[model samples]
Target chain A: MNIPSKLIEDAVTEISRLPGIGKKTALRLALHLLKQNEVHTEALTLALTRMRQEVQYCKKCHNISDGEICQICASMRRDKTVICVVEDIRDVLAIENTNQYQGTYHVLGGVISPIQGIGPEELTIESLLERVSLSQEDEEEPIQEIILALSATMEGDTTSFYLAKRLKEKGIKVSTIARGIPVGGELEYTDEVTLGRSIMTRINYSTE
Target chain B: MNIPSKLIEDAVTEISRLPGIGKKTALRLALHLLKQNEVHTEALTLALTRMRQEVQYCKKCHNISDGEICQICASMRRDKTVICVVEDIRDVLAIENTNQYQGTYHVLGGVISPIQGIGPEELTIESLLERVSLSQEDEEEPIQEIILALSATMEGDTTSFYLAKRLKEKGIKVSTIARGIPVGGELEYTDEVTLGRSIMTRINYSTE
Candidate 1:
C-alpha cells in the first residue's frame, strides 16, 4: 500500500509484526487509532509497554503474574498437592475458565517438539521435575498428584511420557485428562482416533 | 478469559479497543508479544506513540502528512488543475497505488451520513470549496476539474451530489469515477444495483 506518511508507515510495520495481523489490517488499525481520541492511543501504548516491562513470571508455576508468584499458586484454598501440567499460560486460563479444576498449575511453556528444535530443556520441564521431587519431602503438604493436562498431539504425548518417567521415582500419582469428543461435537465430524479413544475410555451410564 | 496478570489484562483490553479485534485475539496478541524479544515490543510501542504524537494533518487537503503540506500537494509533477476528491486518506493511497492519476487529492475526512450525525460541515467540504474558488483567481495552474472518487454507498452518493451542486456554481466541471463490475467480479454473484449501473454506464469498445 502507498502510505502517505513515513510515521504512519513505521507504525503499520510495527503493528503488523504481530501474528495474524496483515498489512491491510495494521493500516486500518493505525488509521482507527489516529481517528480516535489521543488519550485512547496513549492508554493502549502505556498498557502494552507496562505489560512487557513489568509483568512478572511466577517463580513456582512459571505463569505470568504481577509479583514473584501467580495468584493461583499463592491461593490457600487451591489444592496444593495437585499440579495440572499444560503447554502454556493460555491452557492455564482455559482450564481456569472451566471452573472445574481447583488444583494449581505447572506451565511447561511448550510441549517437546524435536522438529522445531524444542526439547525438554527449552520448556520448564526441569523445574517441574525438581518441584515434584522436592514436594515429596515437604511434611506439611506433600504433592499427591501430577495431572498431565497437555494436548493430545504427538509432541504433547512425548512430553507427557518423559515427565511420567521422571516422576515415577517420586511415587506421586501421574494421570492425564480424558480425551473425548467435545460436549456439542457431532459424531459424524469426529476424527477416528478421538472417537476410538472416547469409546475405549467410556464410563458407566448412570442416569441420575 | 481468566488472565493471571493484571498487566496482561490491561494490555488485552487496550488492544481489543481497535476495530475488528476481539478479546480472544487481543489475548493471543498479548501472549505472542510476551514470548517475543523485549526489543520487539519496545519498537512497536515506540513507533505507535511516535505516529500518534508526531503525525501531522496536511493543511491544504486535510490528508495526513509529515509537514504542513502533503507530498502530493507539494509535488511539482502533479497536475494542479485536476483534484480527486476522496472520503479519506485511504482512498488517496488506493488511487496513488494505481499509478494512473497524476492529479492532487482533496480528502473530505468522511462522507455525508445523517445516520451517524455527519454532514458536509463535519468534513472538509468548506475548505475544499475555498481551495477550488481560490485556484480560479490564480494566474498559473488554476484548477479546472473536480473528480469525485467517493464510494458507491448511499452516503457516498449523497456527499457527491452535495459537492456536485456546490461546485456547479463555481463553473468547474464535476465528474465521478465509473461505476461498474470490478476487474475480477463475477456477474453471477454481482448485486443488481452494481450490475445495472455497469450496463447503464457501458463505454464503447474499440479494438486497438
Candidate 2:
C-alpha cells in the first residue's frame, strides 16, 4: 500500500504491530481515528501511555494492579486460605465475572512452556509457594486448599502437575477444576477425550 | 469484563471506542500492550498522537498529504488535463497501485448519502469545480476529461450523476469505469444486474 502521507504511514505501521491487526485493518483504524474528534485521539494516546507508565503488578498475587497489592488479595472477605491459581489476569477477570468463587487468586503470569523458553522459575510460582509457607506460620487458620484453574492445554497440565507435586510436600491439599462436557453441550458433539473423562468421573446424581 | 486495575480499564475504554473494536478485543489489546516492552507502547502512543496532530490535507486535490499540495498534483509527469474523482484517499491509493492511470485525482472525501446526512456541500466537490473552471482560464491546456471513479453504491451513483450533470455544462468529457463480472468470476454465480449489464454492453471480439 502506497500511503501518501508520512504521518498516516507511521501510524498505520505502529498499529499493525499489534497481535491480530494487519496492514489493511491498521489503515482502516488510522482513517477512523482521522475522522474522529481530536480529543478522542488525545484520550486514547494518554490512556495507553499512562497505563504503561503507571501500571503495577500486585506484590502478593502478581496480578495487574494500581498499587502494591491487588484489590482481591487485600479484600478481607475473600477466602485467602483457598487460592485459585490462574495462568494470567484474563482468567482472574473471567472467574471474577462468574461471581461463584469466593476465594482469592494467584496469577502465574503464564504457564510453563518449554517451547517458549518460559519455565516455573520465570512465573510467580516461587512467590505462591512462599505465600503458602507463610500461611502455615499462622496456626489459627492455615492454608487449606489450592485450586489449579489454568487452561485445559498441555502447558497448563504440566504446570499443574509440577505445582501439585511441590504443594503436596508442604501438606497442602491440591485440586484441579473439573473438565467434562460443558453445561448445555450435546453428548454426541463432545470430543472423545472429554467424553471419556466425563464418563470415568461421573458422579451419583440426586434430586435433593 | 471485571478489570482489576483502573489503568487497564481506562485503556480498554479508550481502545474500544475505535470502530469495530469491542470490549473483549480492547481488553485483549490492552493486556497485549502491557506484556510488551515499555518502548513499544511509548512508540505506539507517540505515533498516534503525532499523526493526529501534525497531519495536513492537500490544498489542490483534497487528498491527505504532508505538504500543501499532494505529490500527484505537484508532479509534472502526471497528466494535468485529466482528473480522476474518487470518494476518498483509499480509492486514490488503490488506483495508484494499478500503475495504469496517469492522471491526477480530486478526492471528494465522501459520497452524497442522505441517510448519513452527508451532502455535496460537505465534500470537496466545490473545490473540484473551481479547479476545472480555473483550468479554462489557463487557455493553453484546459482539463479535457473528468473521470467519475466513485464506488458502485447508491450514494456513489448519486454523486456521480450530480457531478456529470454539472461538468457536462462546462463541455468537458465525462467518463466512468465500466462495471461487469470480475475477471476469473464464474458467470453462473454472478448477480443478475451485473450479468445483464455485461450482456447489454458486450463488445465485439476479433482474432487480430
Candidate 3:
C-alpha cells in the first residue's frame, strides 16, 4: 500500500507484528485509532505498557499476579492439599470461571513440546516438585493429590505422563480430567478417536 | 473469565475495543504480549501513542500526512485539474496502489449515512466546493473533472449522488468508476446485478 505518512506506516507495522493481525487489519486498526479520541488511544497504550512492565508471576503457582504470590495461592480458604496443574494463565482463568474446583493451581506456563524445544525442565515442573516436597517436609496437611488439567494434546499427554511418574515416586496420587464426548455433542458428528475413547471409558449406569 | 491480574484484564479490555476483536482474542493477544520481550510491547505502545499524538492531516485534501499539505497534493507533477473524491485515506492508499491515476485526491472523510447520523455537513464537502470556486476565480487551471471513487454501498451512492448534484451546478464533469464484472472474473458465479450492468454499459469494439 502507498502509505502517505511515515507515522501511520510505523504504527501499522507495529500492530501487524501481533500474532493473528495482518498488514490490512493493522492498517484498518491504525486508521480507526486515528479517527477515535486521543484519550482512547492513550488508554490502550498505557494499559499495554503498564501490564508488560508491572505484571508479576506468582512464586508458588507461576500464574500472573500483582505481587510475589498470586491471590489464588495466597487464599487460606483454597484447598492447598490439591493442586490443579495447568498449561498457562488462560487455563487458570478458564477453570476458575467454572467455580467447581476448590483447590489451588500450579501453572506450568506451557506443556512439553519437543518440536518447540520446550521440555519439562523449561516449564515450572521443578518448582512444583519442590513445592510438594517442601510442604511434605513441613509436616502440615500434606498435598494429597495433583490434578493434571492440561490440554488434550500430545504435548499435554507427554507432560502429564512425566509428572505422574515423578509424583508417584514422591508417594502422591495423580489424576487426570475425564475425556469423553462433550455435553450436547452429537455422536454421529463426533470424530472416531473421541467417540472410541468415550465408549472405552464409559462408566456403569447406576441409580440410588 | 476469572482473570488473575488486574493489569492483564485492563490490557485485554483496552485491546478488545479495536474493531473486529473479541474478548477471548484480546485475552490471547494480551497473554502473548506478556510472554514476549518487553521491547516488542514497548515499541507497539510507543508507535500507537506517537501516531495519535503527532500525526497531521493535509490542509488542502484532508489526507493523513506528516505536514500541513500531503505529499501527493504538494507534488507538482500530479494533475491539478482533476480530483478523485474518496471516502477516506484508505481509499487513497487503495487507488495509489493501482498506479494508474496521476491526478490529486479529495478525501471526504466519510459518506452520508442517516442511519449512523452522518450527513454531508459531517464530511469535507464544503471545503471541496470552496477549493473549486477559489481555483476558478484565480483563473488558474480550474478543476476540469471530479471522479466519484466512493464505495459501492448505499451510503457511498448517497454521498456520490449528493456531490454530483452540487458539482453539476458548478459546470464540472462528474464521473464514477465503472460497475461491472471484475477483471479475470468468471461469469458463471458472478452476481446478476453486476453482470447485467456490465452488459448494459458495454462499449463498441474497434481495431486500428
Per-residue lDDT of model 2, residues A1-208, tens digit only: 9999999999999999998999999999998898788999999999999999999999999999999999998998988889999998999988998889999889998999999999999999999999999999998767899999988899999999999999999999999998899999999999999999999977777832
- Which of candidates 1 and 3 reaches a greater DockQ? 1
Residue pairs whose backbone atoms clash in candidate 1: none
Off by over 4 Å in 2: A204-208, B204-208
lDDT of 3 by residue, B25-142 (tens): 9999999998889999999999999999999999999999999999999999999999999999989989999999999999998999999999889999999999888888877678
lDDT of each: 0.92, 0.93, 0.93
Candidates' chain A TM-scores: 0.92, 0.94, 0.94
Give the interface RMSD values of the models in order.
Answer: 0.9, 0.7, 0.9
Please estimate how well model 1 matches the true structure, expressed as its whole-model Cα lDDT: 0.92
Error of 3 at B6 (Å): 1.8
Could you give the CAPRI-style class of model 3?
Answer: high
Sort the candidates on TM-score, descending order.
2, 1, 3
Best-performing candidate as measured by DockQ: 2
Chain B structural similarity (TM-score) per candidate: 0.93, 0.94, 0.95
Question: For candidate 2, lDDT tens digit of each residue in B80-152?
Answer: 9999999888999999999999999999989999999999899998899999999999988799999999988
Model 2 has a DockQ score of 0.87
- Candidates 2 and 3 compared: the better one by TM-score is 2
The interface RMSD for candidate 1 is 0.9
